[model samples]
Target: MRAVTYDSYAKDNSRLEYREVPDPKVGPGQVLIQVRAASVNPVDWKVMAGGLDGMMDAVFPVVPGWDVAGVVSRTGPDTPEFAPGDEVMAYARKDVVQGGTFAEYVAVDAPAVAHKPAALDWAQAAGLPLAGLTALRSLERLGVGPADVLLVHGAAGGVGSLAVQLGRDRGARVIGTASERNHAFVRELGAEPVSYGDGLTDRVRALAPGGVSAVADFVGGQLETTLAVLTDGGRHVSVADPTVEQHGGHWIWVRPDGAKLAELAAVVDRGALTVEVAQTFPLERTGEAFDASRTGHTRGKLVLVP
Candidate 1:
């Protein structure tokens, strides 16, 4: 199997290389997926640079990816949930960081795999698991609903884009913060777009009048904006800032849950949600993909086709 690997933490991402590696062995409760498409997230480059060393143990020559959309080529014993040829997707994060979704094939625990949504193409399906799951969890934690004014930071980015739609579907009047260039795109996602940066609080206040009922921070460094615009006793959560917990808000980290992923897929199938893909790269050009993701400027997901 040919896969991209980094021998060690390289802040410059100089160690990423594509080469032949041994095929993964399927263990009990695991299923082997022939990788069709893998999505690039900021964490992929961060992990390659040792950003998560304290949180996860990384084996040498680590493969870098987590979101995958593919077909089952093989299934391990006791994995009665799926068989070969099943089209599936997953946020396939394991306790260890060596075997990831960027390879030609990856073996995932059955509990973290879900049937792919028929409405999404390979790139879109690959983009959904992590971003969709994160958005879903954030909204669920905040208990967003009708009669609430929801504020979403980074509303045009990967996770934020999905959060905007999900919030609107829940009947919340969503106010999304994005750049001037992305305001139109954010508005298309069903949110009233507001430009972020200086005077962000005023922009949001102009829309909500009193303050927002909830704030979902998909991009970090928005604690001040969140605190300023949230109504009294309102809810807030941040995937980028753990300090939110100290300020009476939740710092959310998404987990691998197949059941939840399936539910998100159903939402897509019902035409209530959609995944946006900004670009697609071949397996060998992962370095370029990572660079693009690190820029934080892309409007949607960046996918890799293996």
Candidate 2:
């Protein structure tokens, strides 16, 4: 099998390499997937550069991607939820050492995957798992509902884009913050777009005079802005900065839940949710994908076809 991997934690170009590798074998509760597509997240680049060195325990020579969409090629002994040839998508467990999806094959835990939405292609499905799950967890933790006014930061990026659409589908009045170039794109996702810059807090205040009921900060640097617009007792959640214990807000680390993913797949199939793929590259160009992701201005997810 062909795989892209890093020999050490460094910049994307310093370590990422595409090469032939032995095929992975399934374990007792794992399923082997013939990967068609995988997507890059900030975490992939972060891990590749050793940015999560203290926060996460990772083995050297790690495969970095978490989002995967592919066909099932084989299953472990006790697995019965899927059979060979089922199309599936998932966020592989963060704790895994060698099971990342940036390859021709991956042995994923059977309980971490669900059928890919029939309405989406392999690339779009590949973009959904990690970002979609993060958005879902953030909204769930904030208890956002139809009557609430939800504020989302970095609304044009992968997780934020999904969050905006999901908030609108859940009946919340969605407000989003993004750069001037992405204002129209965010608006198209059904959120009131507020330009993110020096006066972000003021912009948000101007839009929602009564104050925001819930806040989800996908961009960690905008913590102060999110705090400024949220009303007292408002629900606040962040997927980027989980150490926010001082502000009466909660942090979300996306977990792999096949059942929750199943529900999200249903929403996608029903046209209630959408996954955006900003760009696609072959596995050999994984370094280029990481460079684009680190630029912090990608309109949506960047995918790698393996």
Candidate 3:
């Protein structure tokens, strides 16, 4: 099997290289997947650069990716939920391994995966697990409903885009902040788009005169700005900054939940959710994908077709 892996942690050292590595074997409660596609998230790059070294207790020669869509090639002895050849998608547990998705095959915990929606292709399904789960978890915390007005920062990016759509599906009125170039795309996701730079708070306030009922700040730098437009005791959440305790908000770190993934799959099957892939690259181009993500302006998710 060929894989993209790094022996050390640094931007300069994170070059892609191919090697004849042994394929992973499934253990108890695990399933081996023939990876078709995997999406890159900020966590991927962060882990690659050792940003979470203290938190994760990572080892060297890590492969960093969590979002995957593939076909089950083998199931462990005790696994009864799925069989060989089942199409599946999942977010890998962040702590077990840095990432195993940048390869032809990888072993995943059976409990972390759900059946992939037949309506979606590998690339689209690959983009959903991490971002979609984050959106679902944050919205659940917000308790958003038809009577509420929800605000999402960085609405054109992966998590923000999904959050906007999921919020709309739950009947919440959504207002999203993005760059001018992504305004139309964000609006198409069922949210009113507000420009994110300079006076963004005022722009959001203008859109929701009475103030938003909840806020999800995908971009942590705009914390103060988002706080300004949220009503008192309004649900506030951030995925980027977990240290944020000042605004009565909680930091949301997405976890692997097959039940939630099942619900997300149903939404996708019913045409209520969509996964947008801005670009796709081969495993050898992992470094380039990280570079693209660092530019901070990708319209949607970036994926790797392994």
Give the winner by lDDT: 1
The TM-score of candidate 1 is: 0.99
Q: Report the lDDT tens digits of candidate 1 across residue range 137-242.
A: 9999999999889999999999999999999989999999889999889988999998988898888888888999899999999999899888899999999999
Name the candidate, 1 or 3, with the larger lDDT value: 1
> Candidate 2, residues 193-220: lDDT per residue as tens digits?
9998888888888999889999999989
Q: Which ten residues in a row have the lowest lDDT in candidate 3?
A: 11-20
**Poorest 10 consecutive residues by lDDT, candidate 2:** 92-101
Cα-lDDT of candidate 1: 0.94
lDDT of each: 0.94, 0.88, 0.87
Q: Going through the candidates in order, what is the number of backbone clashes in each?
A: 0, 1, 0
**Better model by TM-score, 1 or 2?**
1
Candidate 2 Cα lDDT to native: 0.88
User: Which residue runs does candidate 1 get wrong by more than 4 Å?
Assistant: none
For each of the candidates, the C-alpha root-mean-square deviation to the true structure, in angstroms, is 0.7, 1.2, 1.2
C-alpha RMSD between model 3 and the true structure: 1.2
Model 2: residues with Cα > 4 Å off, grouped in runs: none
Rank order (by lDDT, best first): 1, 2, 3
- Looking at model 1, the pairs that clash are none
Q: Report the error of model 3 at residue 209, Å.
A: 1.4
